[model samples]
Target: MRRAVIALVITAAGLVPLLRYHPNTTTTAIRATAGTAQTPSASSKAPSTSGTRTVTGSEVDTEFGPYQVQVTFNGSTITDVQIVEAPSDRRSQRIAESAAPTLRQEALRAQSAKIDTVSGATITSEAYAQSMQAAIDAS
Candidate 1:
């Protein structure tokens, strides 16, 4: 009985830290802009001099952090996709760093945001796709 009681106490103690641990759940208030030139208004869409247009997507709030992207379009063709914002936390940073290239490649290949999510970075991938789609739509 005494051993069972001690084991129970230890288990409870182990669970205490798990219960106390809280991740960053607060959402940021960053907004996205659509334009090659920096503009104050979110609705403004400016075309670059080289006949390409860069459009920034709306910021997507995820459990990790805000995700956003900027897409450059040459007429109707997507020329580039750039991550404008992402989670800065160490774990998230690692995941983003590894996943970004694959995601970019997929987006470029698909010519849209309908790309598969990275295996371990589901949340970030979803957020990235949403932001990328928004940018594509804006452009």
Candidate 2:
């Protein structure tokens, strides 16, 4: 009985650190990026949306940090997905750089933000999709 009690104490001791440990994560206000689209000009008042237009998506907060994407449309088709502000952490940056292109392609090809997310980039993928969808909605 005493040995069992000691083993239980050891197990609880091992689990304490795991429960208390917290990884560093960042959260900050969204800032405009170079890729952010500008307001349309008076001359750009098209009866039909033939010209390209860009829309910024809503900021999404994820485990690593805040992320946002800007989407551009050529008429009704999505032509681009720009990572206006991806997660600032190094790990997130690497993941984002790799994921952004694929996300853009998928968004363009799908003509929507509802594309299959990259396997290892769940947080980035979700933020990308949300931001793209926001742009599409704005259009």
Candidate 3:
């Protein structure tokens, strides 16, 4: 009975950090390693037909391995950018998590491919930027 109790305590202690851990720690670590700020060049622009449009596709050759992004645009401006697929590694996941908001905000506001990169995941940011640009390009 004593041994079982000790094992339970150890298991609970081990789980404490994992459950209460702040994801920001990973973001901080990634930022320390990968400097932020990415700007994508302007690709050729195409005319839009009408109404709101959504483009969905995946970019295979991304910095954080294979990633998929879905982009939504209204008229000529992007309204949303969502990460449909992300990396398996924990560090990469955190990077992806950090970049999503930046990607969406910049894409919607800028209405151009010149959105700034995420603080930690420059490559992942670039990949999202490029994929989003491709969506813009397609539209």
Candidate 4:
């Protein structure tokens, strides 16, 4: 019984530190993903010509629901996107905001949905891709 009690105490002591040591995994992942997601590839060169264009598209049956996106294209490149509608939940909203940079970067790079999804935000990433596709189609 004494040996068992000592073992229990040691185990509990080990776990105390483990529990108290906060890794902040979520923040770390978000930061890493945010960093990788924004870097532009070499292929996404800016258009050489000067002209303004616009495109609009909508995505349905996403994890969130239907969303509409409008993109402004200059020459052959996508310049900006206007979010007409987004998911209703707070988490989804946050995800939507976070995903914008990733989506825009991809659009600048490959000009399509071929870009990678943001880590830990799969559903939100899909939503962003769909919306971006709509914008590309419109353009």
Tens-digit lDDT track of model 4 for 20-108: 97452232111111121222223323433346755555543454544555666676667776555666767667877787677667766
Q: How much lDDT does candidate 4 score?
A: 0.58
Q: Which candidate's TM-score is highest? A: 1
Model 1 residue 34 distance off true place after TM-score fit, in angstroms: 15
- lDDT of the candidates, in the order given: 0.76, 0.74, 0.65, 0.58
- Compose the digit string of candidate 3's lDDT tens values, residues 4-107: 99999999999999999755322211121122212221331345655576675445354345566677666666777788777687888888887788788887
* Residue pairs whose backbone atoms clash in candidate 1: none
TM-score of each: 0.70, 0.68, 0.60, 0.55
lDDT of 2 by residue, 23-54 (tens): 76545433323344333334334423787777
How close to the true structure is residue 22 of candidate 3, measured as C-alpha lDDT?
54
Candidate 3: C-alpha lDDT: 0.65
Count backbone clashes in candidate 2. Answer: 0
Candidate 4 stretches greater than 4 Å from native = 1-50
Which regions in candidate 1 have their CA more than 4 angstroms from the true location?
Answer: 1-20, 24-50
Off by over 4 Å in 3: 1-47
Residue range with the least summed lDDT across 10 consecutive positions in model 1: 35-44
- Reference-based TM-score, model 3: 0.60
